[model samples]
Target: MATVRVGEVEVGRVQVGGGVQIAYARVGHGPPLVLVHGAGLDGRMWQPQLAGLADEFTVVAWDEPGAGRSSDLPAGFGLVDFAHCLGAVIEALRLGPAHVSGLSWGGTVALELYRHRPELVRTLILADTYAGWKGSLPPEEVAARAEGAKRMLAVPREKFDPTLPGLFAGDPPAAFVPLLGTMAHDVRPETMGAQLLMMAEADQRDLLPAITVPTLLLWGEFDARSPLSVAHAFQDAIAHTELVVLPGAGHVSNLETPERFNRAVREFCRAHA
Candidate 1:
């Protein structure tokens, strides 16, 4: 295993499925809490949660396949592929029945993991994510969303400063903005593009009922990406779930308002664990 310091936290790496190296870190020492970042982010995205939760539980943040410091994707890289990769990581690390949390696209993958390998998950946390395209806009709307994503990706890394305001849904702390930039620039654009396409085509509406694990849905009050309606739908559809909206928070509430996010998550895990 290799270690690198991102700010005050020490991150580590491990080789997993497909012989791909997956990055992860462990801190504290209770029930396992596995953290998964969104589409354009790596394991480092959970700095706030890691700092807060690590005092109590085993906080684990890792890079998804084809993103961050992890190895490249194997053939047929899709949501299923990524979810299986998560399962593989759990088995490889022997962290069974772990409390899993994910944001945006990562949330979708977490749900997929519960659906495909329910026995491996102890609890579920979904933030700023959606179930399917049913309530989502039609093809034209999706195309527009894709176009906007393209524009964001098209901006040259040098010109695309992370210090800009409104980088996420709600404005994050000034100290946190640079990290967002680092994550944005560190991401491989092609991998982001492929994952965005995968997200757009994914539909898990039918599979929601299959997830019986206790779930927590965290939504930013003004998340333009997933929207509040998506959170409501997920809460209503899932048999065992609770919805918590972060006031004045945006898409990346965990980063923008770590205290609120961490508190809610910690309470939920303690109550359910």
Candidate 2:
């Protein structure tokens, strides 16, 4: 259980299960707010939220298995495996019934957590995410994404580029570029492949209507990956959902518009708390 300091945050690793260690960065003290990052990224992506929201919430961002300081993606790992691992992290830290927030592929994991362990989630904050490619996207798009993932997996680590064109409506933010590049460079082929494949095949539309807790849908106005239409679909499907679109933002809204994003999350969590 080694730990280090990332500014005011305590970055550490915990053994969840199967001898796997999950890395997490925790800060502040209040209601627990666990953040899950998107594919090809890690907890570092949530640095803004960890720093901004800490004054009001105990923010914790995890580097999911195969992503950051965490262990490799074990064989036969699926979406449920990710959810179970997240549940284990919350339990290990005794942060159950927490406000679980996820972005992109991480959103899918949050939904899975709610489906399998509803008691562990107090409210859900999903941003620039999908219900899974199959669930929210057209068949053609899903097929294309699956093919792209396959192609990406074949690229050598040195040649791999984690930059997705639509991630930002304009250029990548100046302050985040270095951090983003570093994370992109560190992306593992095996982990990216598994996450992409799982996303391409997932369909969580069936679980949407069954959600009982409050769900805040924070979307980027220009989110090319998961567009506004997808956000509408989520708003319509989930019984208790509120949609807030961040203007002038793209797929990674939190990074593009941290102030607005943080405000939305803080208000939502406080209301629910």
Candidate 3:
């Protein structure tokens, strides 16, 4: 295993399916906890979670394909490909039956993983995510989101800078904004587009009733992007699930309100473990 540090978090890169190398950072030691990051972000997005929860659990965060050290996304790549890669990473790390947590788009990927390999996931921690654009949201809204994303892709980089504030309902951390800007820059345009397309076509509503493991829905109280309605739909659909809405936070709850976010997740994972 190779180790490198992004800040204080020491990360390692490993070659997985089809010569794709996935980059991941880990902390602490206990029952394995794998964190899947949202679209447009790498594993570093979970820095706060790793720092806060590492004392009690083995926290591992990964950079999805084409995001960090991972290989370029090939043609025809979709959610199934992402899920397969997720499984490969878990297998490579030798983390048996881990508690999986995902944020935003990562949440959808988590569901896909569960559908593909039910044996690998021990518990589900989905934060501010939709079942898929088709699963929870209206068709019109999905079309709008897809169009907006495509427009953003066509616009110049400078035009995209002004929209970053929409990610939160309240003022985000001063340093957090710059950190996000840097992360956004690192992501290739192709990766962003592919991830968006995957979300656009994802449909996991049929799989919700089949989820037999413990599930927790962590959401931002004022999340404009995903909204409380989506959380309600997930809670109503999933047979066994609890939803916790963090007050004063937005889409990116972990970075926007790390203390509350960390405490809630730690309590949930521990109660079950």
Candidate 4:
């Protein structure tokens, strides 16, 4: 067993390609556990997990290109390009066949990574994500989400207000709501547009059954975005999958119910390790 020094959160930059450097926050020391955050969020979204689970795993949460401290998206970049960037992050960090976890769009990104390079990923933990809105959600909901993403870019930076209330099931902790606000303020509108476009076109429904790695699905019991039905779909499609529903949690269960989320992941990794 290994443990990390409980101190400051370590941050670094990795150049994915085209002079663009992606940012990541790492903590702990052990087998690598890479966290990919959802759309409109940076690696900061995984701060709770990093803070709690650092003792057992080398947990790293990454900012996607165009989010957090990462560089802007280059010309002609698409979903596959994002997948390759994840591979680059793993390589640059020297994680060595890590356990990968993703939330919301990040989960789709994880699937893309699997599609591009299956061997690099040892296990996958997908939370609050869809195969693609088209792949999993109803057509009407997909269009609505697409429209919402488009409208989000129209929001001015000064007026950038993150919808924190929707992320939790009921009243969230006093601490978390403000954190969401700060993260929302840090979001780059230009990069958000690219992510929105990616969401509109991404479709990983066909890839579900092909996933060969041990997979876990963490669903917020009250998740309105990627609801329980989506988890059912994932379990029905994928092999060697396990699902856990976080009680009293909404879209961002890992943050809303941090202790439960952390415990689930640690036990799963320990079993696999």
lDDT of 2 at 215: 96
lDDT of 3 by residue, 156-188 (tens): 765553243357877867768887877877877
What's the true lDDT of residue 196 in model 1?
71
**What tens-digit string does per-residue lDDT give for candidate 1 at 124-187?**
9998876633334466756765666667668886654322223366456687878877887887
Error of 3 at 151 (Å): 1.8
Clashing pairs in 3: none
Candidate 1 TM-score to native: 0.89
Ranking by TM-score: 2, 3, 4, 1
10 residues in a row with least lDDT, candidate 3: 157-166
RMSD of 2: 1.0
**Runs of candidate 4 exceeding 4 Å displacement:** 1-6, 160-165
Worst 10 residues of 4 by lDDT: 1-10
The CA lDDT of each predicted structure is: 0.79, 0.93, 0.85, 0.85
TM-scores of all candidate predictions against the true structure? 0.89, 0.98, 0.94, 0.93
Candidate with top TM-score is: 2
lDDT of 2 by residue, 174-267 (tens): 9999999899889988998899899999999999999989999999999999999999999999999999999999999999999999999999
Best by lDDT: 2
Candidate 3 stretches with Cα past 4 Å from truth are 4-8, 156-165
The TM-score of predicted model 4 comes to 0.93
lDDT by residue for model 4 over 161-184, one digit each (tens)? Answer: 545236677776677778777788
